[model samples]
Structure formats: structure tokens, C-alpha cells
Target chain A: MKLQHYIGGIEGLEPSSFEKKVFVQPWEERIFGIHVAMMGLSSHLEAVKSVPTKFNSFWTWGHLRQGAEGMNPFDYFKYRYYEKWLGGISGFFVESGYVTEEELSTKTEAYLVNLEAPLPSGGEPAIDAQIIEYLRVGDTPACDVEAQPKFKVGDTVTVRNPPPVDHCKLPGYLRTKKGVVDQVYEGTYNYYFPTGDGVGDPMPIYNVVFDSHDIWENITEPNTKIYVQIFEGYLEDPE
Target chain B: MTENVDRETYSAARVRALESLLIEKGIITGETVDKVIDFFEKDMGPFNGARIVAKAWVDPEFKERLLADTPSAIAELSFPRGMAGAEGENMAAVANTPEVHNLIVCTMCSCYPWPVLGLPPYWFKDPTFRARAIREPRKVLKEFGLDIDESKEVKVWDTSAQIRWFVLPERPDGTEGWTEEQLAAIVTPESMQGAAKVAVPA
Candidate 1:
């Protein structure tokens, strides 16, 4: 399927194609609210595990996408974005052994037991608002590891159209496209996989300027430029 | 909005079930959820962005520092600790000038400057906004009720994990000699996202 570009006034693309409404159903708001809660919960869980020191949305997103894949195609498309998060968290809990398939199937028993128990103290919870806020704001993955930038500002490069990998920051639309490095951030940046088993090596990040004509086949205004953040691994010396 | 409705099949039910299970397991408590919600609702949000923008408008040196080094400049002001986390890390500020108007979008995913702008709006995360913002920013801006001049160039910045971006909207003409508080009153979350211009009070 051709991914819809946010570009305005392109030929053959209608404004109606945009799903402009913020939310179509009331359930969507509930899903969003719960998703925010889950984010805090998941980060706390990840911290308690202490294997991965950082919170990675890509990790959660991978699981979320995988869970959606299990659903019927129609349901997958029909469900709102946060609904996918809700389902994905369910699947993740099971997969990570936080809960069991039988437990999920028999939700009532677990629900009743928890409801009956006296509420725990705020201090007892594995993660609190302060930690959540810290996780939200601290420890950017940019590292001080010594590394030379492969490309410099103004260098012409092409996005490496490598075969699809399990997880990536590189957008599919920009693959094999040419752009100029508008700005170069001089530091090795580490991007951890959501799975937390491994991380992409620290590398310089660049702001690459791709002309509108290059991004879209049809050019309305050639002067328009799109600035995208790209990692060194995603760029190749254009042949 | 009906408070009591049958919603067993809704995702919220599933979330409740999950929350209960976590509580039962002694992993988290009801307070944990409340704290997270309260932080976003009360402490951290676009209000912070408004304050920063107001400061920049009144203080020229701070504005230069904000545009040059956003995080450090932000630290100069007393916001609650934790400005350098996942959402706020590597933040860069783009100024909206008469010559240029900036629009921020994340085509890959919803990567936003949460410390200043708080969470992204629902439409900001939509696939349509991500895909079209780069291609047709002018039209998208117009849809948001912002009509940029035809002569001015619109620069669309696609934010990501590496760098988060927020816009410093131009101060309205009538706000001269106004206190920072008065200037801040006019800043809106949409203006920080470059979706709408800062409202000029009558």
C-alpha cells in the first residue's frame, strides 16, 4: 500500500483522504488515557527488571504492531491507535510472563482479588511520578563515545535502502532517496532496540534536506524542502 | 457523555484488568496511575512553553540562548527537574518570523517536545499529519486556521528521537512593554506547534 504523504495540494491526492478528525469514538479517548497509564506502568516494570536502563517506545511499539498482526486484518484497521496499544500491552504482559494466558482468559478472579485487597502505599509502587517524569526527561541516548562523523554538513548522500529489518528509525519513503546534509550533530548516538537485547552503535545524527521534487514524483513548488533527522547508518555514499 | 454505560468490550476494561493484575502482584498501585496523570495535567504542559516563550519575548539574551542551546536555557528557568528525558532531549527551538514560518511534524512517529509542549495533540500523531505536513505544509497550516502570507517560506521540521523541536512564535505587535505574565497569557499550545498563531488580545 502506498503510504499517504502529508504534502498538501499534490495532484491526484484529495484533501478528503486525510483522516482529519482527532477521535471518531469515545472509546478512543479511553484507550489514550489508559495508554498513558500503561506507559508509566511499563517504564516502571522495565526499571524493576533493571536489564534495560532506558524506556524505549520502539520496543513497546514492536510488540504493539505484532499484537495487531494477530488480529483479523479488518479489526486491525478498524481499531483506533491506542486500542492497538492496549492490545499490545496485553500481549506483552503474557509474552513477558507478567501474566498468563489462563489468567487473561479468567480475568474476573484476578480482578476480584485485587479489588478486595487494601490499596498499597504510594511509596510501595515500583515507579512513582518523579521517576516517571525523570524517565520522560532524562538520559538522552546521545553518548560521548569517540567516533568520527562519516559525513559532514553540505555533503550529498543517499539514504541506504537496506532490506527491511525488525526495527528501524529510517522511514520507508525516504529509502534510496538523495538529500544533502543540512546540519551534522557531532556525537555518537545510541539507539536501543525495544527488545533491549541490543543497541545500534553510537553514530552521528544529521538533518538531511530532501527537496520536495525528490520526495514526491510530481513537483508543485520545487523550492519547498523537507528537513528530516537521519542517523549515519541510514545514509550511503551516493554512487 | 453518559458516565454509566456497558463497556466490557472497550479497551478501558482491559486496562482496568491489567491495572488490577499489576496491583495484585504488588508491582504498582492506584496512586502510581494518579501521579502520572496529575503530572501531565497540572505540572508539565504547554503552560511551561508559554512561560518560556514569554520570557524569550521580553529577554533578548535568553531568546538567543534558547535558540542556541534550548535545554540549558530552559534550565535557567525553574521548571521541575527532569528536562533531559526521552521527550525533551536534544530540543531545538525554531523562531517564527515575518520572513519564515515553521511547522513541526514527526513523520516516523509522534516524537514531540513533551517538557515544553507536553504531549502531542491527537491530530499531530495522525498518519495524515505526518505524511502531508512535509509535502503540503501550507495547506495543512491553512487547515489549522493559520494562513501564512504567500511570500513567506514555510519550513517544516520533522522531529525524531535524536532531536525534538518547538517553535518560538513572533510576539504580537501590541504586546510591547507588557509584563512576561501578560505575554505568556497569549501563548497557546497550537502556536508552539506552529499549528496556530499566537492570539492577539483585543
Candidate 2:
């Protein structure tokens, strides 16, 4: 039970702030942009072929989340949101041999000395074009195959409490809870890779509605209901 | 000499270094990160979502379509080239009404509708918010200064899988004859997330 997976319904947390800024610090904007570039140019996309580039590793939200999931549970909470992104992403570049630890450290030290230092300019226009094109078309998870949904609207189902893995789309609170299928989504969706706990193959997903009391009993607010879109692999017919 | 550099300064320098390195290598251009940021600033953001909500407020048929099918309804409007791009590939909308209200959250990580709502606000990504929203949305909303009467149904949409959801906030009264542009001005990103209501300026 990774503490990260069970964020929902965690007991004794402080009232959260309603900070509306997308990036609290200007630096967060840079890391976010870099992550988007990585996703757009990842080797998995056909769009990557349009640009002549040396970056040829499959990267996606799944990979990024996997990195966060792999962190020490305490460290996961210790870092601010984009701080984690900066760490995971830079680590990825080094591990992938796209850049070296020593080189990055040297550059970082240089920037520390003179924050106004300009960056090296120029690369293929096709690189930016490909990244922008990705933003336009997007890498949709919807596969062409028909979903053959097993459950239908109003069918009662139980969320499978699968064994723990590094990462999961399943909310920990929803595991072992029962709910009714509200909608069998239009088509089969595939994850970037198999999650090992059952989801990842192209399969039908469902919108399941759980009554608030059913999930948290009497501790929840009145007239409250929770709706979660769950992958089929994380759900069962409730034996 | 620099053992105690503040968190922001260290992170800022480190990311600049990484971006600099990626550009030096053939991985990405010097222009790549800037272009990516520009896309969000100009083309994609809460401004687009405001327009959609405003239009839905005036056009009954369009509102029905938006509630019935989100992506298709959004395509009807002339905005950026990527209304269905990035994290918004499969966007869904749940409208708030006098009888019911909706809140969107991602308990695992923040999976948001980027093309429409842009990047999620800082609070939306906070773990405390994610943890409490599913368990006690009404309480969470109260903390955010939104109060829901017990008579109303509070629907918390947890974006746990393929679908990324956002709220279609109800239009506030007292502006019946307003233009869509005027209505859009009052529609806030916080309102669209169900954390607060769209208020008429006093």
C-alpha cells in the first residue's frame, strides 16, 4: 500500500489552500515546458519521425507518474509538485544518457554564478514544429478497436483490490468498494504500458458511481456522491 | 559558499541548466520550451473554458450538446486549433445546477483538461485537496468558501482513468441580457472546478 495511492480519504489533513496560479514560481514554467517537449517528441509517437532528433526513448505521463511512485513515500510528500518534476525529469535525461551528471552540474554551477547567462541557440525548426503538432493532434489513448463492454449501465460491480505496484490509476479508497456502472465509455483505451496490476491493454472503461456513505460511511458529507472513471481491469463482477 | 541557497534559486538554476543542456544536445531546440509555453499562454487556458461556459449560458441547444457530449460541443466554437489536444483528448463536463453541484479531482495525480482549463491551479494539484475532496467535498468546498446546502447533491468526479473531467459552472443571475463575451468575463477557473461560484461583480 503505497501512501501515494491512498491520498483519497486520508485522515487528519489540514484544510488545503485554494491557490489558483498554475505555476507558483517562474521556474516551474520551464520544467513544465520541458516535460511537454519530451512527451511530444517521445519515440512512441509517429510525430517524432517528422523531426530529426536524438531523443528516442518512449516517455509519457505513465513514465512520469512511475518515477514519482518510485520515490520514497516521505520524499514524495516533502517535494512541492514541480520540484518532483524537476528531479524526476533531470534524472531521466541523465539515466537515458541524453546528458551527463557532470555536465549538468557544471552548467548549473555556471547559472548559479551568472543567472542572466544566455542559452545556446538553434536546432531544427522541425523539432518545435513536431512538438507543436503534438499539442494540436495529441496522442489519444482511444484505440480503433471496439470496446466490447462486459458491464452495462446499472450493473453492480466491485473494484478489485489488486496487489500493489509502483504506480496505479486505481484510487486506493475505491478498491474493494462496490458501485454501479453508470456508463461504458465509447471505445477501448490503452495505457502507455501495462500497469502489471491488470490495466494497460486496450479495454473498455466505465464510469462508476459510489454513494458517499458507502465509501466513508457516516463520516462523509450529506447528499455527497463520488464518481470515478475506472479501467475494466481494476473492476470485477463482484464474486 | 552556496550550501544554503534558497529552494527557488537552486531549482530555477537547475532547470535552466537542464534546458540549456537539452538544447546543446540534439534533443530539443532552444525554441522548443518557449513554443510549448506560448501555446498554453495564447491558445490554451481558462479563457477558452470561460468562453465555452458563457456560450452555454446563452444558447440552450449548445448547452444541451455540451452536457451530452463535451468534445463535440467544444468543436462547434471557433477557438484554438487544439480544443481536443494534449490532456484534453477525452474531456467530459458535468454541469452544476440548483439541485446538484460537481467538483473534479485526480486522487492519483493531477490529470486535468489542459486545452480547456489549461494547467491546473496550484490548489487543485495539492495532495490535501485530492485527499479530502473525494471523502468530504462539501467540507473541502466550504474551506474554499463555497457552501452547498444539504438539500443539494454534491458530485465529486475523480479523474482516475482515461477521462479528464471539468465542471460546467452554472451561470449566476442578474445578467440576463448580457452578451456571451460579458458572461465569459465573469466565469472564473475556480467556478469551473466547482470550488467556487461565478459571482456577478458588485
Best by DockQ: 2
Q: What is candidate 1's CAPRI-style docking category based on DockQ?
A: acceptable
Residues B119-164, model 2: lDDT tens digits: 9999999999999999888888898999899899999999988788
| Cα lDDT, model 2, residue A143 | 94
Candidate 2 Cα misplacement greater than 4 A, ranges = none
Error of 2 at A154 (Å): 0.4
Give the alpha carbon lDDT tens digit for every residue of B1-202 in model 1. 1135344343444566666565565555556566655666676788899999999999999999999889899999988766666477788899998888888887755777878877777778765666677777777777777887758877788764488899999998887789999999899888997888888877
Task: Summarize candidate 2's per-residue lDDT along A1-239 as a digit string, tens digits.
Answer: 88889999997999898999999999999999999999999999976876788789999999999999999999999999999999999999999898999999988889988888998899988989989999989889999988578899999999999889977989999989999999989889999999999988899999999998999998898888899999999987545
TM-score of 2: 0.98
